[model samples]
Target: MSEVYDRLRGEIVDGTFETGAQLVELALAERYGTSRTPVREALRRLEQDGLVERGDRGMRVRTRSPEEILEIYEVRISLEATAASAAAQRHSEFDLIRIRRAQAAMDSTSTDDPAAMAAANRAVHEAIWVASHNGTIVDLLTRLNNHLTRYPATTLKVQGRWAEALDEHRALIDAIEQRDAARAHDLARDHMTKARDLRLQIYREDPTA
Candidate 1:
């Protein structure tokens, strides 16, 4: 049952399950070669995570509006900036090495595939969050980022933006490496601000965003 829940949660976050779609318990059970019990339990957990919703009809995936996307980004900017600041103040040499590894992965994959870029982007931020040494911050970031995965990769898929995004990340890493908490905070904030604006633009272009 826990395994079922984990699998379903991963599919939902990675866009395999998608948003605004019905999650029929029996169907899911058959699809996963499991019984209805685990499927129902998984749906319950997904609902708690805000990844799914329940109504008189049944369970369905949650949908986000353009406004909701913007709000999520705004919240991310604030939280991630604080995390970056904390990471800068607390990070050790080992943390720096881990972050550099993630950054290198991002640099390599950002230009290749949307899925890889998304994974690498997540890794980089998670590394930073680990450096913060605040479990609360890490948990919040995990939840927020899980929600963020619902959005399309179109913003990051922009033609010239990948390189620019890598550069911004490099700048952020430089600040963190220097142990400049204020600079790391500001850079992370600005990075997310631009990402928010870009995503907003993407949503505007696609009303279904």
Candidate 2:
């Protein structure tokens, strides 16, 4: 059942099962080569994770509205800024190495490869969360990050967004490395605000966004 749950969740995150697509139990069971029982259990778990919801037709992937996406980012800005502040005070040399490595990966990734850019972006943010040394914040950010994967487009894929993001990340790392908690917090907050604005711009240009 856990295997079924993880595989289905991965597919949803990777955009294999798009938003609002129905996940019929028998279909998923056949796809996973598992019995209907495990498929049923997996769907239940995904529902708990806010990735799936019951609909008139059946269980479908959750489709977030533009308003909801904005609201999520607002919350993300708060949480992530706090995490950056904490990380500034708590991070060790190993944590800095992980963060720098992720940043370097993002820097090297071609702008044409949105998927790799998105993965690298995630790595950079996740490294900061781990550096915070706060289990509760890390767990909350992890859940928020999972919900973010449901979006059809990556913010990093927007024109010129990757370059801006790389610059913001570099500044953020510098603030953290200097143990400037206040500056780290402000930098993180501003970074998220810029990302939110860019994402909204992308959504305005594309109805599907």
Best by lDDT: 2
Among residues 3 or more apart in sequence or in different chains, the pairs in candidate 2 whose N, CA or C atoms overlap within 3 Å are none
Please report the TM-score between candidate 2 and the true structure. Answer: 0.91
- Against the correct fold, how does model 1 do in TM-score? 0.90
- The collision pairs in model 1 are none
Q: What is the TM-score of each predicted model, taking all chains together?
A: 0.90, 0.91
Stretches > 4 Å off in candidate 1:
10-18, 207-209
Q: Kindly report which residue stretches of model 2 are placed more than 4 angstroms away from their true locations once superposed.
A: 14-16
Which numbered prediction scores highest in TM-score against the true structure? 2
The CA-based lDDT of model 1 is what? Answer: 0.85
What is the per-residue lDDT of model 1 for residues 1-209, given as tens digits with 9 covering 90 to 100?
99999988888876687677789999999989999999999998778676888766899888878878877878889989999999999999999999999999887783657777877888998999999999998988788776766775656787787788889889999999999999999999998898888888877787554
